[model samples]
Target: MITIPFSFIPPKILERLSKHFLNWGAFLEKLFPFLQQELGKANIKISAKQYLAMSFIATFFLFLFLGFCLTIIFIESGKVLGGIFIALFLSLFVFFMQSNYPKILANRRIKKLDADLLGALRAIMIQLNSGVPLFETLVITSKQDFGELSKEIKIAVDEISGGVPQIDALERMALRNPSPYFRRALWQIINAMKEGSLINKVIENIIINLNKEQIVQIEKYGSQLSPVAMFYMMAAVIMPALGIIFLVVIVSFIELDEIVVKGIFWGLLGFVMFIQFIFMGIIKSKRPSLLEE
Candidate 1:
């Protein structure tokens, strides 16, 4: 039921394949809960089964187009086996990317939510302390500019307006949100309300705990970065520089062929680029999931 952008496969054909293909449905069933929870946080409306079907259709068409072009090129170049192998590899890669796209988007949303959470909680605490009703505080926060936090609050408010109890709406958000900090805050709020405790005080405690957690994460990241920094220096800086120097000295002494020299240069460059890519991923993974002050 999902319409892919610029899709070459007709909707009817994709729909038939998705419905008749029992294995795809079963495979998607296994992924539905995790995918559904993530998609809920990101506010995407499509079901997991629909997303899986769309990914399958998209992968099939993409593979067909790429395989045709590659086959033609390989036939012309007299490398048919090479082309088929590369086409299959690339097609599988695309399928993996397509299948995981939703999870990737959800992770991005979770990061943003974590980054904006402290501000959102501060706003809620302020509103609640000023004697505003809990629902009113949520509504006010939803209208403000708190990024993904605001959007999720608005969703909860909408659910409340649609006759869901306020606590139930908030609890639903807690259960589905990807960020642990946001979930903990919502659960604390729910607990406070249920026990008739001071809401503002509960929020304050949650903020304090979240700040402590963030500080710990930051310290851990610093410790992790020490080893990574050493590796980066060795792999990206020292090794490349020494390798280039050694290659230059060898070329002067050995009179290597031009093709061999070019190949060596390209190989070294590719290795440096690969190291840089890996280092960037490590840094990103190490980034603390906390809202800035």
Candidate 2:
């Protein structure tokens, strides 16, 4: 379900081309069998074959477009082969990134679910303690604003309303969800139900365990931050400044052309910016979902 708002080709044309590439898509599915499960976890409502076909078609067009632009630039410098090679490399990189997009999205959903899960579970426990039926508690939870957790619960609520057994609905939700904690909680609830144990006690135990896990996550994040901060300072700040100063001294001794000097400085600036961007992403990725601001 990828959409390009300002694409060079029409959607209809892309769809047509994608259909023709279905065989290639099937081949890709064979090579990376996990894509099917990832697509389900990401909630992307398309068969893996169709998705891979679309991805291949889009990437193919992207390669052609980049190849053309780079060819034009390199033609001016009589380096067409270099342009082709660079374009091929970039195209392959984009294709691999596209292939991993589903897993990335699934992980994001998992984080959002984990961030809200404790509160949602506590809400359910309170409702149950007040004598609300399990189905009613689920229905109420589905109506609340617990982000992705609420949406997932709503799916179970709908399934239960449609004559599916409550346990079966919960099982389905747990199976498809990417959040391990959510699945564990659901399985615990299912066990409690089957054993006819007090659901409140089970929920309370789950909340306590989740709280302990969050504490560990916070401590782990704190332990990681110091080293990451040091690395960021070295790579993005001190190194760049020192490197620029050293480059200036070297350039003063060398008789480089003005354009070449400017190019070198610009390239260094780009590299520093890239380093800063990478470090920032690493820090953000290391942040615990429950601690997300």
Candidate 3:
């Protein structure tokens, strides 16, 4: 195996470190060799200490928030036992959810990386066609001097060096990424290798197909977003505006001194607020994470 120059070591380590923070659960696959067999990347790159620190920091702060919220509820509602019970349940819920949050996001990110895996391989084929040796092509391109594409390639190269078979290494990457498109492309690459055939044309074909797939994805996202934006605008602006108009009409035409009129207005306002919350949830669910792209 070629040794990485001392000059490149710091940046490489730093990049690996930051990558764990960006996707912690996925990092676990790389941390344990046994886990690597079931995962995408096999690097043992991130120290166990890092995730330990993460878990500690997260639990400490979450408990504090839970305590504070419980205190507030106890003071206002005068139900200490009930508040404590609810708070305990909520604290556990938040702890697990918050602890898993980074991993969930990382899983999605890994999947996207997998989706982009075939593209990276195609780039490698291009580099090879231009006479760059496989190892150097991997080393240079994996360094991410070319962007995130390099980072993933670098990890794949690491797996190869770590004595993992090429097919397993590719499979690990596919497992980690969990993108069906990426898996399809990777399986094709593996098949080409098994047949000992030229990959240049196949690589080009895969690139074209990936581009088309991405365009279709963009269009689909666009369709989802357009309706969401319209809904938000209608719920946030149109509904509120209509509510205000109704309020004015009631004030001008009806003697709202009766309790029933006031009750109706309050009921309408509450219903509107409930609808707003439901719409907000829909918007949140529809929007993709900022990290995916």
Candidate 4:
């Protein structure tokens, strides 16, 4: 393996730190299972142990870098207590980022899967109604260009071909997937198989419900965009422009120190960028997962 600068802490050390020293098992028991499940759904090949190790290592390095920068800034500025506060804040930020990385990946995967779900499900229903067996329908779907859903169904097809029963394989896939809609469809298919109900009709009903859900989501998103766009405009554009103009006007009237005036200008710029990032996150969070484009 290629050695990196941060490789001083061996993987074993990180693993042991995660397992015994931190007692992560006790505190993380609730969240780690879902993390593992998300890893599977996201098609990430790393184990939860490996994922945790990587996250810790990355977090440590990130904090290390931030600490160095803050130390220099605080020492030059002669603010020892502020340095400590900044270090604590960075630690908390690292903790949050480490804890949520897997969830972020899983959410991305779920979005991609949902984006293509309607088309995939419609194709499956068509194949089933045409008298194709469930296994063949999945295989055929897997051969298509449905993105993550296709890749996931391909995994199910591989499992079924490897001697796992179709229903069991489908159930396993559904259990590991992050989307409730995906799981509900799989459960209905499983039930249809058990009860000898029409799989085609079950899938058709799912299609209709999913379509209704998409329509509702579109309406909600449209309603949501107005306020978000207004906030973005005020915080990121209008506020910054007004602040810079006010600062310039004040500078023209008073003899402020060059350092203080520069600091205000740069600080305002950073705040504007920060607000833009917050609005970007809000937009991402509000976006419906089922949107394909």
Per-candidate local distance difference test: 0.82, 0.86, 0.59, 0.79
Candidate 4 versus the native: TM-score? 0.80
> What is candidate 4's lDDT per residue for 1-293, written digit by digit as tens?
11112334565556555544244433443566677676676666656655665555656666677677778888977886687678768766765666566677778888888889999999999999899998899999999999888888999999999999998999999887778888888999999998999899999999999999999999999999999899889989998999989998998999999999999989998998899889989988889988785
TM-score, each model? 0.85, 0.92, 0.58, 0.80
Note each model's CA RMSD in angstroms.
3.3, 2.1, 10.0, 4.0
What does the lDDT read for residue 247 in candidate 2?
83
Tens digit of per-residue lDDT, candidate 1, span 10-82: 7667766676555675586585667666556556686667667766676778777878888899897799878
Error of 4 at 139 (Å): 0.5
- Residue-level lDDT of model 2, residues 205-224, one tens digit each, is 99999889889998999999
Worst 10 residues of 1 by lDDT: 1-10
Top candidate, metric TM-score: 2
Candidate 3 residue lDDT tens string, 1-293? 11112122344454454444645544543544343222223222443334333443444455566667787878777776676677667656654553344445445554556444655666677797998865677776676443444565667789999998776776666555444665677677777777987666677777777777667766776789787878777876787789878877978987667677678678777877887898877765544322233
Q: What does the lDDT come to for candidate 2?
A: 0.86
**In angstroms, how far off is 288's CA in candidate 4?**
1.4
lDDT of 2 at 183: 94
Number of the candidate with higher lDDT, 2 or 4: 2
Predict model 3's lDDT versus the native: 0.59
- Please tell me which model should have the higher TM-score, number 1 or number 4: 1
Better of 1 and 3 by TM-score: 1
Q: What is the descending lDDT order?
A: 2, 1, 4, 3
